[model samples]
Target chain A: MNRRALLGTAAAATFSGAMPGLVRAQAPGIKVGFVATLSGAGAALGTQLRDGWLLAVKHLDGKLGGLPAETLVIDDELKPDVAVTKVRAALERDKVNVVAGLVYSNILQAVFRPVTESGTFLISANAGPSTFAGRGCNPLFFTTSYQNDQVHATMGQVAQDEGYKRVFVMVPNYQAGKDAAAGFKSRFKGEVVDEIYVPLTQLDFSTELAKIAAAKPDAIFTFMPGALGVNLVRQYRQAGLASTPFLSSFTVDESTLPAQGEAALGFYTAANWAPDFPNEVSRRFVRDFEAAYGYVPGTYAAQAYDAAMLVDDGVKQAGGRLADKAALRAAMEKPGFTSVRGNFRMGANHYPVQDFYLCKVAKRPDGKLATETVRKVLSEDTDPYAAECRMR
Target chain B: MSLNLLLVQLLNGAQLGILLFLVAAGLTLVFGVMDFINLAHGVQYMLGAYVAATLGTLLGSFWLGLLLALPVSLLIGLLLEWVVFRHLYRRDHLAQVLATFGVILTVEDAVRAIWGSSPLAVPQPEGFAGGIEIMPGLTYPSFRLAIIAAGLLVALGLWLLVDRTRAGMLVRAGATNAPMVSALGVDIHKLFTLVFGIGAMLAGFAGALAGPVFAVAPGMGDGVLILAFVVIVIGGIGSIRGAFVAAILVGLIDTLGRAMLPDLLRLVMDASSARQTGAALASMLVYIVMAAILFLSPAGLFPVRRG
Candidate 1:
């Protein structure tokens, strides 16, 4: 009797699975494989991105472009090999129509080929590596986030405009870090006193901080992200180096400011958007995000919300015809939805041509720490690498 | 490097070494007395920081939080030994390693579930909030200096306890021959539990102290664990004195290498490539030194004397 009951259930399950495909053909639902670093030290950024994307979907009544949307959130664990393997599974096993969300550039570099080779619509919420922005640009790839180099370049321009003759630069020794150094140097034609590259896992910066004090440069520019930034900012102040102008990108942002506390106050960073962006979309996002997640939305969250909206608009424009790659690509290129960053458009390379802002860390009225926009630094700034991108 | 820079770097390295010593002391003792490869040892350090940060904020006093965390850490260690580690004591070394590694994963996940993955802030104590001029044109954080001094005090207290007490004698005997000590009618199991608890407390202490200076986040202990392992291996496994000397040596080498290698390489190569290669090489210096020391002395620099 038990065997007979099991057989009956199995037959019912097989029939129910077939029912989804039959229904899917009538109302073309979308499946998104959201891969991000949801665990380990970098998990904070990944969590923010994931939450932001989910919040956008929730705002759309749990559907993208009037179709039922199903998202499979996968934790990359910040490991390259793991990202490649899981992304492959998401593409092949799950047959996800769109792949979105990655926090680290290294992970993006690892999964880019497998994703693009399969001809899937890859929407990068963050980690816009310079390699893809330039000659390696693919029509299949699109980034809601600005190119990595472009944000770092803003700080470089700031340093130069402020008449800083000598600058001490520090970044993690990785592809993104190298790009940051190159980007900064492209704009600032000054003597770079020293460029210290620390390991990604390094939490202590006492030795490097010592070197900075000895050099006594006009300013210090760094690109340490996540916990690295947290430790560096606090230690910099503790070591009495706060007197030196702390110029950075992604180092003194909303995600890290909570841990950095008063140490990050008055420190400057450059980004495309902040929590205090003065617009209806951004204001609504910050208010809803804080109400939902109990934390201020950072740039990671803002960019990811844009990525989801882009996908939603793309699907809407394509009339839910996901299989038509060209139509979907064109729809995504000119995203119809209002961006949180008011003036945002896709560049020739599929990266954002957006205004950049110089932001300062400030304590909010409710005593929460967040980044506030100081002023606009670049208006409709396209990445330098776009000229090299010959997108087919 | 200039004289001022060198002096500050030295202090930084010494502070790092002191923290490594505190963590390694417990690790070495557990390994030596029990012959158990406790890969989960690092999680104790992480737990220490987490408990301190949470309680410190709650009670509004870093000192009170630190004081309360020690007993809590001790209780957690004892509970872990009773629940999980006791069963694994009779297991083989590979089994112990695999099991303890499982513990590390379980604890890391639990931490994330409870505290979330973001780093927690542990404010510096009131008195040690700023830097003091250690040398002309060079200032160091007083909190770091306090850490170094506290570590030294702990080291001295540990020495007195281990070298000048009856419990210390039993621990030495157990390290030499656990079976013989058992045969001599000592409660070997109790000794094992005691050593394990103490080791956990020491590691927890280090973590709590590190909270104000370093990042208090999940998996924060993993990197320190690797360095502590290196310290024990290079110091001669199971020797506190050896762990101390080796920890300081490793710390100085790592700190100085990172600070000086790039500048040194610039003399022979272009500045950009030199910085790149130097950063790569500096990270490798610790492991390279470990290999060299292991080659020179297979049992490490100061192998515990066996009867």
Candidate 2:
């Protein structure tokens, strides 16, 4: 419509034709796609991941390595097929050179191979399965989160250090659940009373709780997150066993902790990040996030924040050129992005080899629920399976 | 293990049975009376749990929350039936299923829009939170026993209403032939509304009862809906007595299979193998029972009187 616009379009076309190589030399904005379950049972965690990413991008003021950035977000709905298809669309249609934000290990496994094989960069915010941390690791895959086994292994170490001799293990019957159990058993050298594996979405835990109580272990450890975590904590409290020491690998996050309230009090949990880690970056994230969102950010948010920062560092390292996939990835391999969890370095397997903190819920000096940094459970904890990762 | 351990497992099995009966009772009635398959019935259960959690959190009392949630859920259930479910009454099973499936999507989304998709935990009553030692060595959750008692009471009340009262006569007759009941000067639409509302209330009640135990989140109804359908298939679609007994049987078998099968397997194998094999077998127990029942009695133990 405007005479000036038509003239600009004609001149732009002529200019683009004249300098084809100039386009490659110029600063190109990075396009990244994020896929996760954004509308189902795990939707809250997914939203947290999304928010963290947006906040990181917001902090960057729409720039990664001095070039503007664009993000493509898709909802996976917790279905493997849908997640895979979404990844393909983001890569092929959206033309995003890098993909990030996988919440579940199952979804990550469904996503990792396709993007890696296609020579696209995948920056995983969460869900680094041991296989990918180990023999299945690919050069294109980089996880900001620790391997799933690393967290569980640290949990086991916490239990062992606490002098727990008899423990009952419970996890939903699934691949990840089995992995959680095996990883814990690898580090835990105590007497195990029983291992009860229930269906993934089982609601009624009365029978299972009875069995757990019957085993009468010194302590009970479980691996159930999302809805399962809420259900288990509520039912465990209802089972009149609150006094019993409960250890969990993936529970007691900001997402579930508020809903749990006093019920989560005194529970021991292990994680790579917590709100009270005493780091300036983490403290600021907690303070500002609490003031803004009216709730604390969980590990889900923390991992996602790290993921975005990692991408930012990679883009900057590549001198703002995301089109060169290997150059951008090589830039990502060296770590200097200060995440909320302090400086995290990528290990040989592409998963973060970071510190694991054994934390217990206790009322701080102000009578607000916060995690007590019980101990640095593992320093520079690397996955045993990582040696098998053949990432070039 | 020991005798006390056996008693505890049995008690657990019975508790799960009672809860399943509460959910199955409504589903069987809806199918048997109206010849309508309502897939969103479980969504009402989710609504009930949500209402209870939000109300309980606001009021700081579990019982009060349950009380306040009942009317809200009932009104919601009736409105949904009037606006959505009533239209599907004349539709075929395929159409009804599709429409109700849409309802599931709308309701789950509505919950997410309102509650932000986080699992909300409703605390148990102060009194019922703890278990009671029934025997010298065995203790069972008092709240679970209360559930069993409540389920039995509802079952008895339903039996009296369907078998002993004049309204019961009409319902039974309507199950046999709705057109004939309409010919006797009763409005069929009114009957359908009443039946749908009651079925929804039962589902809401089950949802309410389960709130303290399970997290109230979007799509929590899916697993429960599948189990309730299994109950209907085994108990006979329209028969209330069949629903109750079949619900209990299925619940017991599923729960006990999960709890005991692995230990029983350990009688012959090592603990690890027994755990793995038992976990798999336990999950398959209910389906296996459903298959056996279908094989033995083609139309369930008691078919609806439509034929």
Candidate 3:
């Protein structure tokens, strides 16, 4: 064989029945591959996804099929190339019938092609990019979380109602960040003074904070999560520019709250759930998690826990049978389970049409980092992109 | 923009540049002297931040945390060299990168497993928390000004140490002629360990110092590592003076570019388009600058002991 042919042969060895990864007996079992950001700064979200899914697996005794099963989990590392490779391996080598767990919209986009081609059902735990909800929505692909824009829409409602006359918007240099700024604009009826875009994983923000300060807007709205949030809070506080109200989505949470401390005292963060949600499931999970992990679980963890419960309940409702792929997909569609978020239901886009809550960081009487449910910012919040979905 | 705001941003840019210098200094030297691509160097920086955060939490004093974290970081560096890095000394750059990459994975995972995924931070020392007036209307954060001072002092100390001390002479010699230095019966192994430890200590100190400014999170060092690599590449690996000059250049360019690029673009394009285009361009400016520098000078501005 020529060099190209030999290379192709070696590559073809990955998917052929003759490959070592192809297992005959486990073919009937539901092979669910989870694609998530498991490395780099993106690992924070992936870690939460892994924990939630693993917790679900533990509760279900590693059996998702109501029968023998195998779960193929690979770290996409939040890179496009990695996602494509992982998706191919999962479909060809692992022969997974179902795949889930995406933290970023971009990664979801990269892996969706391979997933759709293989007829594999993709259950996105997070990252409901607008495109996928409507015209771009493939029947084989479904989002388990809200569309990316819905979270920002929640913040927009709050901003418009709060009577903030002028605002400044900040987001990472990425698709969702742009969508977030645009999404906020969609519902907010206010003049935006400026928009600052920082690179993802940017730890220093004094310069940007200075820009926001100089703009002197009524409120500052941003969508930076995990480490980015922590950096922004510290820089904001240090700059002695605390008078301006700060509102954010997915930026201020248990993961970043500890780093911000008193600096996070008044910042308002929009989220679908808070640990303080007065529900048995929420309380139980938070208490158990704190007891086990010391730190309070973030909203990412909550969503993760919810996704697992949704899958678990769906599998059980399907007569404890995931033997058939279509039956499993059917069971998942009408998932009947209590999530950590409470009263969970999947929408037509295979995403959640859930309520968005405004959470403010407030120290308890004992002075530990805690968040209070300020109000339901947006009720029955649905992704704007879902209208484009033409599910076959 | 208000004069005070402009002054503060400028100070912030300078402070960031200094911190970059502290990190890039050791990285440049290690690559220059050892001819080893030590990717795990970033972890030492992260470990410094973590050590400081952990100690501050335990002792309730950020200064004490800073002092303790340095030695801990140094100890980690030594331990790493003894167990892992020492074996790779004779190997090529590929082996070193892979091994150090393993170190990064193991250390990062260990940090996550131990510290949990939540970000940890150390409070800025109260003594250094006050703002100082730079001009009639402008004031800068005391902690940040202190970083500039600390970074400058470290830079001077590094120069003196490398130029005036016997160990420094050996290192300078090693960078040029590793085999000859080893043949001279200087106990090259011990020297290498010492160099590695000091390099680790420098990175750690930088991390610990930055803990108050930046959140101590897992994989925080990855970005810094890339930037440090760029700095070393442009400054000439293993050259302290080169790293210093290059670090400041990179830092100033990055900070100023991010601040000014959009405005500059707005000159020709619409404000909104300019801002968006500027943001995308600003992100790539530092890398482009690095590539430009490398293209012009393959061995960097100051090629250490190599001719």
* Candidate topping TM-score: 1
lDDT of 1 by residue, A257-353 (tens): 8788888898999999999988999999999888877778899999999999999999999998889999999998888999999999999999999
| Native-to-model Cα distance after best TM-score fit, residue B126 in candidate 3, in Å | 4.5
Error of 2 at A145 (Å): 0.3
Q: What TM-score would chain B receive for each of the candidates shown? A: 0.97, 0.95, 0.95
After superposition, the stretches of candidate 1 with alpha carbons farther than 4 Å from their true spots are: A1-28, A80-95, A110-119, B135-138
Better candidate by TM-score, 1 or 3: 1
In candidate 2 chain A, where is summed lDDT lowest over 10 consecutive residues? A16-25
Please report, in order, the local distance difference test score of every candidate based on alpha carbons: 0.86, 0.79, 0.78
RMSD score of candidate 2 (Å)? 7.2
**What is the TM-score of candidate 1?**
0.92
**Which candidate number maximizes lDDT?**
1
- CA error at residue A46 for candidate 2, angstroms: 1.1
Model 3: pairs clashing at backbone N, Cα or C within 3 Å: A134-A388, A134-A389, A135-A388, B28-B238, B29-B238, B32-B237, B32-B238
Candidate 3 chain B worst ten-residue window by lDDT:
B132-141
Name the docking class for model 2. acceptable
lDDT of 2: 0.79
lDDT digits (tens) for residues A1-392 of candidate 2? 23322332233223222211111222356777877556666777776776677667767876656677777666677778888987898888867778899888888878878888888988889877776877778888898988888888888887798899998999889888898888888889999889988888688776777777766778888988878887887777767766668888887777787667677788888889887878888887777666655556778888888898898898888877667777887778886778788858988778888899988877666556666678798998888887777776
